[model samples]
Target: MEENRKYPRVRTGYQVRLTHRQYGYWVGSVANMSEGGIFVAELRPSEFTLGLEIDAAILGEGWDKGLPALRMKVIRIEEKGIALAFVEPDYPLWDSGKLSESTQSPNQ
Candidate 1:
């Protein structure tokens, strides 16, 4: 398969909380991540649908203490999980802990 992704992905096992206006909340772990998107694993198929808009928050150790919820759009659905792309490319809050060395700002 051809690798045409704009951002390189890092394999990770960070917990994630997914929220939708209609669906409430669903929890899963991040299988991998890139600047553009994330792949969440172990999510129930019935919890999400393709093209759904959602808000996500990364949880657990090493994550930012005040990690802002991210707005994402479902781009792909796999047998085990779903892929979500960030609506905005710039996510300073998402770059905390193991992901990057930048410090979180209060105004973000």
Candidate 2:
């Protein structure tokens, strides 16, 4: 098959938390990442559906507790995992002020 991805992906081991309004929450590890999207592995396929909007938060060692979750849309599903594309690709992930008011923690 031809590789038609717009952005190149890099392998990663970052832990990620994904939350859905209907499916609850899932914790998985990132398989790879690209500017346009991310692939997360080890999550149950039955919990996701293509085109579903979800929130993703990278759980790094120094991950900011105040940072808002990134909005992503499910684009693909496979045995390995599910692929998600950023809903707002150009959104400033590091700018807490811009997103703080619009998002809240899943725990809340």
Candidate 3:
């Protein structure tokens, strides 16, 4: 395994999408997230590969705003679903339209 920067990431509860293995699609929630990667939960480990493509969206409330088509890659697989290391994770909270993207897990 490669060395990680060990950046402190914030735990967020957001809706995400991953390609289904058998057919159709599967959904996941953001357990935690950093600029480099995200830990998603409630996913089928069997449906992921070392370099699987994952499409995730930061589901929102009130206004129903989220990120654009996000593209990520699976880098590790823990006890649960594969860990997705975003090849390009862009949570542009700067965009006035995306200002709400940083809302931590509702409980956080």
Candidate 4:
């Protein structure tokens, strides 16, 4: 089937720390990403509703510790994890030098 997504997802392995009122904080690996949102793997924590916003911080070797957390809303959920859309989509976050060469997929 043809993909109908406005943004094509690129597979990624970046880690993220998520914070929520009910769930507190937890770490999960980013399964993929696009300019619009990110798919965090192994993030299933209790029951999460659609449109529920959460605080997220990308954590990895090259990522800066000073970067502030992002406000992301749950858009979709699968058995493995949840897909979160940026509450305020900032295109620069995707193209920023901070993402850097180290975090890109092998094919990129």
Q: Which candidate is the best by lDDT?
A: 2
lDDT, candidate 1, equals: 0.86
Q: Relative to the unseen true structure, what is the C-alpha lDDT of residue 69 in candidate 2, on a scale of 0 to 100? A: 90
| Model 1 spans > 4 angstroms off | 89-108
Candidate 1 per-residue lDDT, tens place, 1-108, comes to 999889999998798999988879999999999999899998886667788999999987899958679999999988889999988656454534564335555566
Better of 2 and 3 by lDDT: 2
Off by over 4 Å in 2: 62-65, 89-108
For TM-score, candidate 3 versus 4, the one ahead is 4
* Candidate 2 total steric clashes: 0
Q: Write the per-residue lDDT of candidate 4 for residues 64-83, one digit (tens) a residue.
A: 89999989999998888988
Residues 1-108 of candidate 3 have per-residue lDDT tens digits of 976667777877676776534556778877888888888888877767788776656664532564465678888887676678767536653655554746745674
TM-score comparison, 1 vs 3, better candidate: 1
**Error in Å for residue 31 of model 3:** 0.6
Whole-model lDDT, model 3? 0.71
Q: What is the lDDT of residue 36 in candidate 3?
A: 81
Please report the TM-score between candidate 3 and the true structure: 0.64
Off by over 4 Å in 3: 1-5, 20-23, 62-66, 88-108
